[model samples]
Target: MAGRRTERIDEWRERVDELCYDGERVEHRLDLECATVVVTTQRVLAFVPTTAGPAFRHVDRPNVGTVTLETSQRLAVLCAGIIAAFAGVATLEMATSITVSSAVPSVDLEGIAPLPGSNLLVGFVETVLAAIETGLLLLQWSVLLAGVAALVAAIGLITYYIRSRTRLLVVRVSGDDDLVVPVSGVDLEDELVVDLEAAIRPAPESTPALEAEDGRRTSSRNWTEIDHEESG
Candidate 1:
């Protein structure tokens, strides 16, 4: 099973690599259950695996105007609904058990003495009532336990969902279009943003070099003009 999963991941990675430019190399790769994301020197590529085939989205670093991250609440909401349903069922079971137990008549076992056949009859009634009460108590407890289990599960689910849920990375493109990518980890998002910024922003040192070259060219032009005047 593990081998097969690894093979599938390799296939997805290959698909992502295919979408990159000729010389672009992947700097970071994040593999999600439903999708795979790769950050390259030139662009960010997201590949979603589906029943039909793999779907892909590419966001060029230079075209990304802004990136925004937001948390998703779908899993948390679903877990909350499950917890509420379990609690409701437990409450109903407890109320039903209480009403049923109260409706049954109680026997005065202590007040009755050894009255031959009458004692046997009273003993049987007491035994039957005890069994019924025991069953009701067991039923109530089972329901309560189920509710508690559901509550624990819901709490764990909420905690995990809050911590590990995919973050929405909205990339606003140059033409006002948006490219939404579901990123899993905070570190991955930070790296992606850093790469994007690096790609978009020009290097500060390049400006100084260009200015110096232009100054040298202007000086040479003046020197040439002075030589031409002397020759004339």
Candidate 2:
């Protein structure tokens, strides 16, 4: 009876080994809780403190990555303010120069004191118009810059959202365990799936025989060879 039980155990071990040797195993699961996103991976479980819940856990698969979101309004307003300030300073400088030049009595208006007053008033009004034009130009530039910044930020946020919530899957043949690798860099999220698939490729036909030969060589190297010819 004991022999039978031993045989059964051996058979069971062999079955498990065979299943692992010829199995397709790929899986991923992801979840979320409040501010923290829980990413779980199959077979590659990480041990955490019991206080955090279960001691063993894995990252979430079949889910997208993480995204940090923020509003660009502050940056936009800052840019608009800077543009407006620069335009204000430039307009003030140009207006001052215009006022000074207007005060220099031109020969055309030298004899007519009242006409000079009218001309001076006209120059003052023109300066105000020029200042207004500067303000308008600054406003237009600010709007354009703000629009471009918002567009860029929106596109970035959208891309982040899509990638974060994307479903990632893995497929493997056998082994009760799966490995989930955190991928980074350009276009690596999708590439991770390909890499996982490649990891399960069957070993070459001669690999096992070669491994056996290597084992023999290693054993031989560990001990001196006994030869009758050397003894003679």
Candidate 3:
């Protein structure tokens, strides 16, 4: 049983090497005690390839990596809030100005129109009301434009948050979701495999293994063990 287990481990290691060199996504099934690796252009999700056909729910999910949901949420919320707040402020200012202008007194100009030298203040109220109307129309148009811009920005934020928060992931043997791995670091042709290999490799330990041997060569070597090892 031990030898069989060792053989299986060796086979898995070899497969891992192949996966590393080929730059393919590999699903290591700890539950089933074997691994299934496949190469496909489509991003991996729940299904994995098999000789018979694609296997659904055959492998255990990997939990190796972390997702950055907070950053995306923060950025989208910040952008949307700024746009909405600016639009609200502009709308409030326009409303206040319109209200203040409409409250002013309107002096009648038709009563004093007979005199020839009364032209200066003759239509002051009408002119003021006309100017206020024109200003209100312009302000309404500006508010409409700002509202539309804010709505579009809010929609963009919603879209971004939805995409960033949720994903269809396929867990690899290394306990990582292979689908969401960033491919920006590598060329398109080699990115898939390179990222898979990077995910599977174990972190370096405090003790270093010997160059030619499987055992660790400690910094302080025992002279007696060296002499006995030489004799043996």
Top TM-score model: 1
Candidates by lDDT, descending order: 1, 3, 2
Q: Write the per-residue lDDT of candidate 2 for residues 93-146, one digit (tens) a residue.
A: 544444333443433334454674777866776677667666756655665565
Q: Between candidates 1 and 3, name the one with more favorable lDDT.
A: 1
Better of 1 and 2 by lDDT: 1
RMSD of each: 7.8, 16.3, 13.9
Query: Candidate 3, which segments miss by more than 4 Å at Cα?
Result: 1-27, 30-105, 123-125, 166-232
Native-referenced Cα lDDT, model 2:
0.41
**35-101 in candidate 3: lDDT tens per residue?**
2333222222222222133233222223334322111235656577567757756765665456535
- Global lDDT scores for all candidate models: 0.67, 0.41, 0.46
TM-score, candidate 2, is: 0.29
TM-score of each: 0.47, 0.29, 0.36
| lDDT at residue 33 of model 1 (Cα atoms) | 55
